[model samples]
Target: MCRWLAYSGTPILLDELLYKTEHSLIDQSMHSKLGVETTNGDGVGVGWYEAGEQPVPALFRGIGPAWGDVNLRELARVTRSGLFLAHIRASTGTPVQQTNCHPFRYGRWLWCHNGAIHEFRELRRDLMMAIDPDLFPSISGSTDSEVMFYLALTFGLREEPVRAVERMAGFVEQVAKAHGVAEPMQMTVGTTDGDRVWAFRYSSVGKSRTLFYSTELNALRTMHPELEVLRGLSEETRLIVSEPLGELKGAWQPVPESSYGVIQKGADELGSFTPR
Candidate 1:
C-alpha cells in the first residue's frame, strides 16, 4: 500500500537517495512499479539521526504528495545523515493526515511499514487492547502501521527486535482468528534505534509485499567500478527498500519470503522468520 526505504552507511545527502537515482523515492512516489498502488501521494515523512547527536531521530512530515513539496525538496538537498528512513504513503482505508504517515517515532526508535492488517476494521479494537496500557496513551495516530509499532514496543522491541516482532505478529494472528478473519497480517517493516536496522517481510498466508536490500558495498563497487560514489561510501553502508533505487546489475537482492534480516557493522545476517 506504500513504499519506503531505510539507509545505513556513510553519511550522505538525503537527495542522493530521495531524488538522484533512476527510480528514487521521489520517482517512486509518482510511479512505483512494485507497489500495489502506482502513486503513493497520501503523505510523506523522513526521519534521520545526526552523528554524535542523541540516538533519537529528527523528523519532517507533511500530509501532501511528496513530489509537489518545495519544503521536502529543500530539506532533501541539504540534510545529510548516516542513517535515515523515508516513506511515501498511499492510504489503505485510513484518513490521509500527517499523524497517519509512516516512520513513526518513539524515543530513539523509528519504524515504518508498507503493508496492513487484513480486515483491520474487524481487528483494530482487539489489537489496540493488546498494547501495554502505558504505551497505549502515546499512540497518536489511527493507522494500523502505527499501532503495529506500539505492539512491537510492548513486546520488547528495545532489547530483542526479532523476537519482539514475532510476538506482535503472533498476537495479531491470535486476535484475528478469534474474530474469524482467515488472514490476519501482511507486512514489510523496517525499524532502527540509530545503530542497526532490522527489516522483516512476512504475511499469514505466505505472499507478502516486495522488499530488497542492497548487496555488500564492496561487491557493488567491484561490479560497477565506474560509479565513483559507491567507492566513497563506507563498506558498512547498506540500504533496504521496497524496490531498487537504480537498475545497476547485482545492486539489489530480494529479502527472502517469511524472513527477516539485520543490517549492522559486520556481516549482515538473514534468518528465517515466522509469526510465532
Candidate 2:
C-alpha cells in the first residue's frame, strides 16, 4: 500500500502539510508506521487547485521517492492551494514509472488510492472492459488505482462521487467473483474536483487500511491555543490522510471501516458506506 494526504482548507503553502508535520507524508515514505510497506519510494505525485482559477487541478509527479525529490521540495515550498492531494506510491505489482503515479486526473477531478485490488491480474481485464469506451482511451497506466479512478468516472463520479465509488467497489466484487477471487478489494481513497473532497475506506473483509481526518480547525485551535497557524485557518479547514500526520491529541480521528465522508467549504458530512 501507499501513503497519501488530502488538504481542503486555507490557501497555505504546500510544505505546511507535506513537510512540516511530525510524521509528514515525506517522512512516511521512509518510515511508515501503519502501511503494509515501510518504504513507498516507487513514485510520488501532487495535484492542487488554484483558487479563483479553472476547476481543473494541476499535477506534478515523478518516478522518485518524495523524500529525495528536489523539485517536489521547491514546489511544496512555494505553491499554495486551498485544495490539494499528495501521494507516495508503493506499487503492488506495477512498474515504477511516472505514468503509474497517484493523483490521476480526469478533467476537473483528481484521485489517489492507498490500497490494492487483491490479485489484480485476475480482475484487470474484466474491470477494464467495464469502463466506458470514451473514458477507456484516457487510461495511461497499468495500476489498479488508475483503473478504479476511471471506473468511478464511468459510474458517474462527476455527478455523484460517493455513489459512484460505492458502485465501483460493487462492480469490482462482481467481476472478481466471476473470476474465482473471493477477497477482491481493499481501498482508502481520496478524490476531489477542485472544490469538494471525498474519501472512502473499505475492504472485502472489513479490515481496511488506516485512514484519518483532522479535527475541525476551530476545535483544534481551541485545544492548542498557542498554535498560531491553527488559529489562522478557516473553520472549514480539513485534512484526510492514510495516517495521522502527528500525535496531536484530539486532532485526528480514525475514519470508521466501511465508511466515507465529504470535505468541503462548509458542508462536511460523514456517513456509513458499503459496496453498492
Candidate 3:
C-alpha cells in the first residue's frame, strides 16, 4: 500500500499542500493514519503540468523516504502548478527504486495507484502479454502500479479514461481468478491528462482503501469563513487524497465505496464504478 494526492486548481507553491497542512502528504509519508502501513518510506515521486503549450508533465522521483529527501524539499519549496500529483510509496513486494515510483507518465497523462494485485507474480506474465506490443516496451518498472498504467493505456486510456480503467481492472481480475486468487485486485487510482483529473476507488473484495476529495471551495469558504487559505482558491479548485490532509471540518469528503470521480473546469462528477 502507498499514499498519494492529486491537486487541480490555482497554481500555488507545492509546499502549500505537500508540507503546510496539518497532515500533509509529506507528513502522511511518515505517519499515515488511514493507510495499511504507518510509514511509506520505500520511495517518492511528484508529477506536475506546467502552464504551456507542451503537454508533457515534469517528473521527479527518488528511491528514498520523501521526508528525508533534501532534493524533494527544495523542489517543492519553489515549484508551482495548477495540476500535480505526489506519491509516497510502500512496497508490497517489489524492489525500491526510482523507476518503481508512482505518478507514471506517458504522453501528457500521469497516473499512480495505492494498492496491489493479490497474486501479481502468478499473473504477471499473462498480464504483460496482454499489453499491446508497441506499448509494452515503454514499461520501465516492476511495480504493478506501472503495469496497471500501461494496461490502461493499452485499453484506450487516451480516448476514454473511465472505460479504459474499468477494462484494465476487469482484465486483471480475470487473470487472477484463473490463477486461483479469490480477491484479485485492490486499488485507489488517480490519473490526469494535464486538464482533467479522474480518481477511482475499487477492489475485487468489498472493502477498499481510504480515499477522499476536498469539499467544494465555495462551500468550504462558507463553512470556515475565517480560514484565509480558502479565500485564495477558486471555486473550481479540488483535491483528492488517500486521506484528509487535515482534520478541518467540512474540508474533506470520503469518496464512496466502489466509485470514481472527475475534477475538471466545470461541475465535478462523482459516480459508481463497475469493472467491465
Off by over 4 Å in 3: none
Q: After superposition, how far is residue 233 of candidate 1 from its true place, in Å?
A: 0.5
By summed lDDT, which 10 consecutive residues of candidate 1 come out lowest? 222-231
Which residue pairs collide in model 1, if any? Answer: 9-237
Model 1 backbone overlap count: 1
- What is the per-residue lDDT of model 2 for residues 1-276, given as tens digits with 9 covering 90 to 100? 799999988899999889999999999999999999999999999999998888778999999988999999999999999899999999898999989998999999999999999899878988999999999999999999999999999999999899999999999999988888997899999999887899999999889999999998777877899888786788888999999999988999999989999997666999888788
Candidate 2: which pairs clash?
A: none
- Candidate 1 lDDT, 61-137, residue by residue in tens: 99999999899999999999999999999999999988999799999999999999999998999899989999988
TM-score of 2: 0.98
What's each prediction's TM-score? 0.99, 0.98, 0.99
Hey, what RMSD does candidate 3 come out at? 0.7
lDDT, residue 231, model 1? 76
